[model samples]
Target: MSALPRLSTIFLAAITTLVAVLLYSPLFVPIVSSFFTISHGNVDWSSPTLSTYVTLAENHDILAALRTTLIVGVCTVILSVVSGTLLALYYHGRRSGRSILQFIIFLPFLMPPIISGLALLIFFREIGLERSLLTVVIGHTVFVLAIVYRTVLMRLQSMSRTLVEASYDLGATGWQTFWRIILPNLSSAMVGGAILAFALSFDETMITILVTGTQSTLPVRLWAMMRLGFSPDINALVALILMFTVLLCVLAARFLIPRQVATERT
Candidate 1:
C-alpha cells in the first residue's frame, strides 16, 4: 500500500511539472531575449545589455499603446468594481429573480471572447456608439464584471450576519451600518476583484480589437506588429509586462489569503 501511494504521488508530481513547463516555456524565450541581443534569429547570450529597455522607452507608438492599455484597465477596474459590488449587494438582498439576473450578468463572461466581442460590436453599431477607448473600456468592464460580482458576493455571503444585527441593535441606521461595517469587510474582496479586473483588461485583445477605433491597447498593437517580427524592444516590453503581471498575482494572493485565513479562524 505504501509503495502504491508513493508511485501515485510521483506520477502526479511528474504530470504537474510537465504541465507547468509546457505552459511557461514560451514565456521563457522572450524574458531571456530581453536581456541579450538577437542576431540572425538567434540569441547572442554574451554581453547582455539594457539597450533594449532604453529603446522601448523611446518607441513612441508602443508607449502610446501601453498608456492606452493602462487607461482602459483602470477604467475597467473602476467600473467593474463599482457596478459588480452594487449588483452583488442588490442580489444578496433580494431573492426574487436573483438567478435570472445573475445569469444575465454572467452571460458575457461565460461566452467565448469572440462571441462577446461580436455581440458588443453589433450592439454598439445599432446604438450608433462609435468604437473608441470608451468602447474598449466598456467591453473590458463587461468581460470582467462577473469576476468582481462573484468575488464580492462570496465575501458578502461569508460575512457574519451577527455584525449587521449588532449594528442595528445599537440603533445604527442602514447607511451607517453599511458604511461602518459592511463596506470595511468587503474591502479586501473589492481590491482583489479590482486587481483581477485590471489584469484581464490589460491583456484583453479580442474585445478591444473589435471595439477599438484609431487607438489600440498593448495586446492589440502587439498582435498587429506580429506580421513584422518583434524587435528587441518588444522583448523588453514583454519582460516588463511579465514582471508586472507577477506583481499583480502576488498582491492578489496577499489580499485574498488573509481574508480566507480570517474567515477560517472565525
Candidate 2:
C-alpha cells in the first residue's frame, strides 16, 4: 500500500479507538467502581472488594426489579421469536398487500420509542387493559419485533429451496418437511432473534416506564432511583448486567456465524 493510504488507515484507526473509549467511558467507570469502595461521590481505589455485590444481593427491591426484568425478557423472547419466525416464513415471497402489512408490523420499531409507548399506552387504556408486566412484555415484543422479523426473514430468503423440493420428492409430509428441514435451518436465526429480543427487553426503560404498572423492571427501577443518586450497589448491578449482555451477544454470534453466514454468502 502507498504511504498515504497507510497513514490514512492509521488515522482512522486512532479516531475509532478514541470514539470507542468515549462511548464506553461510562460503562468502564461503573464496572471499575463496582470492585471498589465509594465515599462522598468518589470511588476509592485503595480498597478493592466485592462488598457492593453483597449489598446488591441484599437489596430486595433491586432483586425484585431484576426478577421482573428477567421475566419480561423471557416472555418477550418467546413471543418475538415465534411471531417473527412465522411472519418471516409466511411472507418470504412478495405480495402486494404483504409489503404494507410488513411495514405496519415494523412501525413500532421504526418510530421513536416515546411515540410507540404513548400509542400503546393509549391503545391499552382504550381497550380496558391495565398496565402491568404483561403490558411491558407486549410493549417490548412490539419494539423488538422488527429486529427479529428482519433477522429471520433474511435467513429465510437466503435459504436454498432445493432442500424443500427434495423433502417433498422423498414423500415427506408438509409438517415433516417443516419440522425436519426448515426448522433446523432456521434454528440459529431464531436463537439470534431471541437473544436480541431478550437483550432489548432487559435494558428497556422508556416504554417500560410508560406501560408498566406498580412493578417495574430493572432499568425503570434504576431510573426511579436517579433522583436520589444510586448506591454502590447500582454499580455492581450495572457491571453484572453488562457482563450478562456480553454473554448473550457471544452466544448469539456462536449460533449465527457458522451456517447462517454461509447461507447469506452463497
Candidate 3:
C-alpha cells in the first residue's frame, strides 16, 4: 500500500511537471530568445543583449498595433463589465426566462471562435456595417461577455440575503443598500471579470481578423507579419506581452482569492 501511494505521487508529480513544460515552453522560447541573437539560423546562446528590446521600441508598426490592442482591451473591458453586471443584476431577481436568455447571451462564448467570427462577419455585412476598430471592440465584448456575466452572477448568488435585509431593516433605500452593501461585496468579482475580459480582448485574433478593417490589433498584426517572417524585435514584444499578461493574472488572483476565502469562512 505504501509503495503504491508513493508511486502514484511520483507519477502525478512527473505528469504535472510535464504539463507545465508543455504549456510554457512556447512562451519561454520567445522570451529567452529576445535577449540573444541568431547567427546562420542558430541562436547565439553564449551571448545575451538588449538590442532586441531597443529595436522593439523603435518599431513604429508594432508599437501602433500594440496601442490599438490596448485601446480595444480597455473599451472591451468597459463594455463587457457594464453589460454583464446589468444583465446579471436583471437575471438574479427574475423568475422568468433567465435560463433561456442567458443561453442566448452566452452563445458567442460557448460556440467555437470560428463559428462566432463567421456569424458576426455575416451579421455585419447584412447590416451594412463597415469593419473597423469599433467592430473589433464589439467582437471582443461579445466573446468575453459571458465570462463577465457568469462571474458577477455567481458572486451575486453566493451573497447572503441577510446582508441586504439588514440594510433594509436600517431603513436604507434600494440604491443606498446596493451602493453600500451589495456593490462593495461584488467589487472583487467585477474586477476579476474585468481583468479576464481585458486579457481575452488583448489576445483575440480570429474574431478581430473577421471584424477589423485595415487597422489591426497586435495579434492580427503579428499574424500578417508571419508571412513576411518575424523581426527579431517581435521576440522582445512577445516577452513584454507575456510578462504583462502574467502580471494581470497575478492581480486578478489577488483580488479574487481573498473574497472567496472570506465567503467560505462566513
Candidate 4:
C-alpha cells in the first residue's frame, strides 16, 4: 500500500510538471527572446540588450494598435462594470424571471468567441451599425458582462443582511444605506471584476477582428503580423503584455481572496 501511494504521488508530480512546462513554454520564449537577438533561426545568447524594447517604443503601428486596445479595454471595463452591477443588484433575491435574465446575460460569454463575434457582427449589420471601435467595445462588454455580474452577485450573496438591517435601524435612508453599507462592501469585488474585464478585453481577438473597421487592437495586429514573421519588437511587446497580465491577475487575486475568506468565516 505504501509503495502504491508513493508511485501515484510521483506520477502526479511528473504529470503536473509536464503540464506546467507545456503551458508556459510559449510565453517564456517571447520573454527570453525579448532580451536577446535571434540570428537565422538561432538565438545569440552572448549579448543581451534593451534595443528590442526601444524599437517597440518606436514602432508606431504597434503603438497605435496598443492604444486602441487600451481604449477598448477601458471602455469595456467601465460599461461592463456599471451595467453588470446594476443588473446584479436588480436581480438579486428576485425570483421573477431571474434565471432567464441571468441566462441571457451569460449567453454571449458562454458561447465560443468566434460564434459570439459572428452573432454580434450579424446583429450590428442588421441594425446598420458600422464596424468600429464602438462595436468592438460593445462586443467586449457583452462578453465580459457575465463575469462582472457574477462577481458582484456572489459578493452580494455572501454579504450579511444584518449590515443593511442595522443601517436601517440606525435611521439611515435607503440611498444612505446603499452608499455606505452596500457599496463599501462591494467595492473590492467590483475592482476585481473590472480587472478581469479589462484583461479579457485586452486579449480579445476574434471579436475585435470581426467588429473593427479601420483600427485593430493589439491581438488582431499581432495575428496579422505573425504571417510575415515576428519582429523583435513584437517579442518585446508580448513580454510586456505578459507581465502586465500577470500583474493584473495578482491584483485581482489580492482584492478577491480576502473577502471570500472573510465571508466563509462569517
Q: How many pairs collide in each candidate, listed in order?
A: 0, 0, 0, 0
RMSD of 2: 2.0
lDDT of 1 by residue, 60-101 (tens): 989999999999999999999999999999999997999899
> For model 3, where is the 10-residue window of minimal lDDT?
253-262
Task: Tell me the tens digit of each residue's lDDT in model 3 across 90-174.
Answer: 9998999988989998999989998999999999999999998898899999999999999999989988889999999999999
TM-score of 4: 0.94
lDDT of 2 by residue, 1-266 (tens): 46578879999999999999999898888899999998887778888999999998998999999899999999999999999988888887556688787898899988999999999999999999999999999999999998899888877887888989999999999999999999988899889889988888899899999999999899888877776876788888889999999999888777767664667688
Judged by lDDT relative to the true structure, which candidate is superior, 1 or 3? 1
Lowest summed-lDDT stretch of 10 residues in model 2?
255-264
Give candidate 3 misplaced runs (Cα > 4 Å): 1-4, 259-266
Q: For residue 263, what is the lDDT in candidate 1?
A: 71
Error of 3 at 110 (Å): 1.5
Per-residue lDDT, model 2, residue 18, is 99
Looking at model 4, the pairs that clash are none
Best by lDDT: 4
Top-TM-score structure, candidate number = 1
- Model 3 steric clash pairs: none
TM-score of each: 0.94, 0.93, 0.94, 0.94
For candidate 3, report its TM-score.
Answer: 0.94
